[model samples]
Target: MGSNGSDPPRPVVGITAYGEHARYGVWDNESVLLPRTYPDVVIAAGGVPVLLPPVPESAAAVDRLDAVVLAGGPDVGPDRYGAAPHPRTGAPRPDRDGAELAVLHRALERGIPVLGVCRGAQILNVALGGTLVQHVPDVVGHSGHNPSPGVFGTVEVALEPGSRVGAALGPVATVRCHHHQALDRLADGLVVTGRAADGLVEAVERSGAPWVVGVQWHPEEVATDVRLMTALVRAAAQNRTTAP
Candidate 1:
């Protein structure tokens, strides 16, 4: 049924998009793009999805948003965390790195709810003085977390009871993942809330924020579950209602 006139406005949630070379119809060119799943999940969770392209001033757009989702993409530039790029690390996208880092900081400064998925989780860590594993197989001795390109692997994550991620996803979740890097040396004020059996950090959240969760898995790829996104939207709704 449609909402009555008394219903509140849907919260606007911004999802970051990356610039990439692509082809469509008769033209092949660089494009600002994001997977459709990100917006679809946000909409399913009762939030309006807005795509934020990687631009120097994109951070300013956060001022008009109720929440933000740092969508998954390329590996965060190793230099962002004071490290040399691993031989396995993909080439860096400076524009994307700068834009996302700025956007994340602004969102936190304003106390906006944020969800970081896959590469987004890595971005969250690096944005807050943390480092990354660089290559997961080197540490875990297996490629299960990221079996192959364009293919998502399923990994079980154990959530910490009472944590925001756990509250939304329960104690254990079989999540979709597709990344070779994971959080390491967590930034101050960020707590690990979920982990894989191999002890890789799978999720983290800001200690004092109302909602700043980052998951190493790709929740958007898990079409059957919308709990994580729903939690973010609900938090955004609450933020909208309580903002001064």
Candidate 2:
């Protein structure tokens, strides 16, 4: 990990949006009340927390953010990665997909640091020409991965020695997650940094970037898991100056 110079005094980080299912039309609700305790996590890490709306005007959104976060949400569209929908695939939201793709593209093009969680991780894969398992049970031959359909379950992740993820969370660790899909083909330029006990991919990262890590877990829910947020914020602060 290389440092540009003395770190900037402060930086602003943006968390991606998640749509709401209101009674009327999709009310386009915003996450002002703080999602998954991420606001406190960012503030504790010495950064400002900004809730990013699902507005796809890349330049406008990307310009104001020193770093961007892709938070966990609904499943990514299977068609985005050249596959048919799975029997167990959840509702697909094309609007959210398009908006996030634009945000991701703008961030990557500007060399901004990004941290993806759960569905955000899948989105990272699809954005780079990769595919997903649709439903882990159908492929992994087990139902433990998605234990209770919509509940968090513990999984052991095998981390590659000397990988960025390993350095962040240690050699091997257990993480809590709730998902039905897993990565099938890794995105180009992305290396699998961790995997579940059932041999499913758990985390990935770019080879030489400051911080391009994505995990299949909701680290924000575990406030004690400070490493996840620390690593992300540190990398974002680094990119603010060294971004190319």
Candidate 3:
């Protein structure tokens, strides 16, 4: 898992990307967008990082990767979980919702490790037949989940003593966060592995063969806790060897 010549072939990780109106150079046009830090951290963790733009074909691409990083983006459409949009919800992105859902379905079926960050976490919950709080301020009584605009708020997170996240990053830690929503009705098989100081569901995982987890904070933002990403690459390597 090293970048050196003697290292074994690294696990290939396909990271999800979104389409947005972006500004670069002197041009302002709609374009595919992905934070470079996500892939940079993946490479630093000894994985081959590939940015997967939002497209229907993402389902097929999911098959070729050993792991998937569902990057943070817009709010998932409320209709995905049979709820009406919250007054605080941003504009819908049903097209993107469909694309990532397909990736999640295929990754789970193929036993590929998945790390869902921020918006990715919400999407994970929805993909597994769960719902989101839609507006954390409404549920938690404040903007603790997202303290400010364009800034990563710090929050203390307590991990379940025997949970996968706990094993990866210890029992208690601080994480960088920037989100307005959190998990509500968890999927049946999914277990809450961590919580914020305000009791928001900050982390979750399905206890089984395939490594699957969703974190409400942005570890990639501060590059502070790379254990989750590292764990995924490690699992991906193991999956590669055992893959037929």
Which candidate number has the best lDDT? 1
TM-score of each: 0.98, 0.88, 0.96
Question: Model 1, range 1-244, lDDT digits (tens) per residue?
Answer: 1146788888899999989999999989999989889999998888899999999788999999999999999899999999999999999999999999999999999999999999899999998899999999999999999999998889999999999999998999999999999998999889999999999999999876569999999999866789999999999999878888
lDDT of 3 by residue, 1-244 (tens): 7767998889999999989999999999999888888988898787999988888898899988999999998899999999999998999997789999999999999988999999988889999999998888888898866888887788999999888788888999788889998899998889999998788899999998788889998878766557878998998999888877
From the highest lDDT down, the ranking of the candidates is 1, 3, 2
lDDT of each: 0.92, 0.80, 0.89
Name model 3 segments beyond 4 Å from true: 4-6
lDDT (0-100) at residue 97 of candidate 1?
96
How many pairs of residues collide in each model?
0, 0, 0
Predicted model with the maximum TM-score = 1
User: What TM-score does model 2 achieve against the real structure?
Assistant: 0.88
Which ranking of candidates, highest TM-score first?
A: 1, 3, 2
Error of 1 at 38 (Å): 0.5
The positional error of residue 226 in candidate 3, measured at the CA in angstroms, is 1.6
**Sliding window of 10 residues with minimal summed lDDT for model 2:** 27-36
RMSD of each: 1.2, 4.0, 1.2
